[model samples]
Target chain A: MGVRGIEIKKKTTMENQLHIPTVAELMAKGESPEILFWVGCAGSFDERAQRITRDICKILAHVGLRYAILGTEENCTGDPAKRAGNEFLFQMQAMMNIEILNGYEIKKIVTACPHCFNTLKNEYPSLGGNYEVIHHTQLIQSLIDEGKLRPDDGHIFKGKKITYHDPCYLGRANDVYDAPREILESLDVQLTELKRCRSNGLCCGAGGAQMFKEPEKGNKDVNIERIEDVIESNAEIVAAACPFCMTMLRDGVKVKEKEQEIQVLDIAEITARANGL
Target chain B: MVSQFIFLGILTIALVLFGRNAKKIYNNIKLGKPTNRTDRKSERLKQMLLVAFGQKKMFKRPFPAILHALVYVGFCIINIEMLEIVIDGLFGTHRAFAFLGSFYSFLIYSFEWLALGVLLSCAVFLIRRNLGHIYRFQGRELTKWPKTDANLILIAEILLMSAFLTMNAADYKLQQIGAEHYIQAGAFPVSQYLTALLTDTQASLIFVERFCWWFHIIGVLAFLNYLPLSKHLHIMLAFPNTYFSNLEPKGKFKNIDSVTAEVKAMLDPSLPPPSGEVARFGVKDVQDLTWKNLLDAYTCTECGRCTAACPANITGKLLSPRKIMMDTRDRLEEVGNNRDKAGNIQDDGKSLIDNYITREEIWACTSCNACVEQCPVNIDPLQIIMGLRQYAVMEESQAPASINAMFSNMENNGAPWKYAQADRANWANPE
Candidate 1:
């Protein structure tokens, strides 16, 4: 049978699904799957994201948690589908995933992508998929609290002012504003903020499947508006918690040709740096 | 003598037409669910009542909104005056309203001047429509019309308002010269100036008043009768549209389940939903739509403001949101008129999107909140379009090709991006 019509219809089949991304899916997954780190979409597909996931995986192993990567075997959690108004497809995809996660007996999921984090923690339960979802920044903060992640003073590149960009999914979508900043503060107190933050942070031009389709008709993309805010601060390094934000910000830096002038790093990578593997 | 009867006939016709339309509106509203914003009982009632009469959003955009308010209120009070004039003509004694003496007289004078302002502005509007760019969107040519609808309505207003002015001037003249002393004498400033001009012939002020009153009354009736058939039909439709507008401020859209009785029958014959082979997903086209939707298209005033705010339209996309509404109206009228002739609407085997609204217009919306928000009259072009999209995607299996792959992948892989569903919560895992 052709599965095209099944997309939005699957939503009706699976009633009681809130159709929102859940935050509960960010915790650790698997009993003995060697590595169980949530390779959220940004980390699962992109080489750079995989590298960051691998780096965080490597860093966390030293901190005493066994982790495995979810790579090509990864299934989308339907965030983009819902955002794109492909609700039928979103529900179906979410169901297939709930089965997969249930088979894995996943208890928790940690994601670098807040879209994945928000979907997993906040939305997955509506589809009967339940898992504690946490962001890598939260993990890093937890690791620090547990004394497993200790950053040396030298991990700090002194005299360099840095600002953190809050991804909409992380900040506005899940209210994970403080965790990323706290991780950054453990590294640098220069914690300057862009004018718009938290609930009102500008979208990185990648949310709601805008990454797949064309951008809306506007003089500039939403991400460019966000990066302009970043560049205006003139901070040496612009740190973010979401891979989508990193890509958009970096794209902006390239479009404006401010690449050599600015550095965009995930908060986990920056925090991992202080741990000095 | 005949002028008085003519005025009576005109008033009777206007009342009948307006009464029929008003009954239809009231019945539709009765059939309609309470679609207003989510609030407690009193709050919703207040909002609806206020929105209908308060002109809350009109004030958001200054000059046009204020000018519209003048027309709206002027149109309202003038209805009373029109009927009253007809009454006076058929039966004689013209009674002074609460405004005959002091405060109301000032209001009458000022409102008359303001109505003049609306008339002049409407003239500018007519010129603008004639000279404005020919924006072509969704196959409906929203134009600086060869016969502009807004301008025609404005012209009707000008006719009605001019009649009012002439009648008012004539009333002041007659009453000043003929009425028993103080009241008419005081209110008739314009007539006092005309006293010198009328010295020669006793021009019989009562006859003058009746004639002027007939002009005012019949002129208004002519405008009213022209309203439904004209573009200005939106004036009547806009209030109820606002009243029934979706008040859902929630960011989350309703993601309904797709398993209807038909699909259930197709699957496990036992536990099917009661309806057989029902549309489980969403709307397919015009007839599959809710009646409120039908009303929405019919009510559009073709103001290109929706076009202006539409991200798709602004970005050079083929979607003119206003045209979507217009197309719906045209299609509804076409289908409705033909529904009886064809015996069965589907017998003709014509799809609304193909024969009515185009596929290009369907694909253009980014679902941005602009059109819904910017509509001064509370038209939700996005939802109506989404309803059509529902039909195209779910019922017809006619979604855009780009989203086709995405939808396919989601069905097989459980995610738009085709990631492992099991890995969804993989991020919550620690190293």
Candidate 2:
């Protein structure tokens, strides 16, 4: 039936796990889950994101933090598809992810993608899945707090007037605007702000799957507008918290032919560098 | 005496009865969920000073909007004159607040002129709606509610306008005979002209003025009681609602679980837990909705502004953001009726997509947040749509088959498009 005829009522494909006694289960599970990592679309699909997440996993192992992957490997949280008019695909993807983390006795989940963090942590409970979802910026911030990662502050990218592009997902969608800024501060990169930063950050032409489909009529692709704002501000470097925003803004920089004048970096990559990785 | 009593009786019945029902339903829906911080009183007071009094949204459209602000100011200041008409009828003393007689009289003329101009501007609005050929694709939302009963509103508008002119002519005659003229010779000269019409008969002018004043005041009261049921409801709902508009950007989807979990914890202390059987998530239906949704539903003026902005509607998609609001209003009426009668709303539940709005329409929403931004009154259709989607997906398990499949694939393969679980970190390779 190609998923069309499969009734959720009959076979119970997507379970409304909302009514389950989870706090009691958590009491049995221990103080915290073994792992809490955000699995983003890029973490699942993009080669660079996969590498970054795998690197993160290796770092966690090296640091000896108790954690488990929500999936043994990784999965897309269906945010991309849902944002597009393809609700069917988004729901299909979301319902398919039966994250048997409960069976594995896992609680906390840390994620690399802001998109996944938003979708899993924000949008998922409607489909009856709830978990304590944390992003890498937050996890890294906690790690820094625990005195695990210390910056040498001699990075080559230092002393540049760098402006940060708050990704719509991370900044506006999740309100995680400050952690990335704190990480950027740790690197000693000169921080600049755009007029439309944080909650008012413009969408990169990627969200709602506009990255896949064409950007419809607007003054410009929201990302291009943002990148131009950065260029107009004359900042030398632009860093972002989300990979999707990084890729989209980087593409925008390329399209504008200002790549020589500007650089785009992710929070994790910057954090990894600051720690002298 | 009886007519005055009857006129007021109608207003009293409408406000005390119908308005009470609206208020009751409003309060009940408000009681559906606790409102956290939607209406910040200080924020509203600040917006009243900065935006509403400053005429900010009007400033966006410029000239016509300036004229609109004049009418708005006129509406505010001259409401006292309406009270005078009622008081004079019920107790016979007029000019209740005539301390600066010339200035107050000038205000009367100015407010009257502004009312005339407001109607002219409303005519422009009617023309834009009818002939502008805008809002084409928002399909039914743009076309349906706005289309129906617009002519009646227009006709009543014209009638009220003509009444204003006629009433002014009669009152000018009265003021000419009874008191000082209310206008400059260069500006109006109507009172000067009224001398020729009134041919030294004070008694006749008094009767004419009394008749016009009565009709004018009665017409206004009729308009007021009618306001709650008409497109003009925006007149009242717009100002208050705009002042209470959501301060956050329309595109920002705040985490719903954190808030709902707090609510659930407060509501039921010994509740078992969140698992797979229920949603600690977005609203699944109107019944599942919070108070703001109901307010947003009631607040819709069916102006089709959101429909006009909807890209999907522009692309000939069946969805109209404005129509969803109109339908919400329509549904609220039905639901309220059913609830009042204590009838169980049948769960042979007609699929919302099929019966209320189209599935294609529901799917067509891009969530671009334009509708929310452009809705001068600050209605958020995106969250409402998400809530409805939540209900269908969570409780009903009724969704587009493709989404179900995507969920399956996500469960098994860890991607919307099924991909190898091992391949998840495949992208993290060195470029």
True contacts kept of each: 0.11, 0.17
State candidate 1's TM-score: 0.67
Residue lDDT tens for model 2, B158-277 = 566555555556556555555543232112333334446543465666566666666677667666666656656666666566666666534445444543444344445696444554
Docking quality (DockQ) for each candidate = 0.12, 0.11
Candidate 2 B-chain TM-score: 0.79
Q: In model 2 chain B, where is the ten-residue run with the lowest total lDDT? A: B182-191
Interface RMS deviation of candidate 1: 6.3
Worst 10 residues of 1 chain B by lDDT: B27-36
lDDT of 1: 0.62
With candidate 2 superimposed using the best TM-score fit, by how many Å does residue B164's alpha carbon deviate from the native? 3.3
Candidate 1 lDDT, A127-197, residue by residue in tens: 67788778888888887778777777765544467888877666644566788877777765477777656
TM per candidate comes to 0.67, 0.63
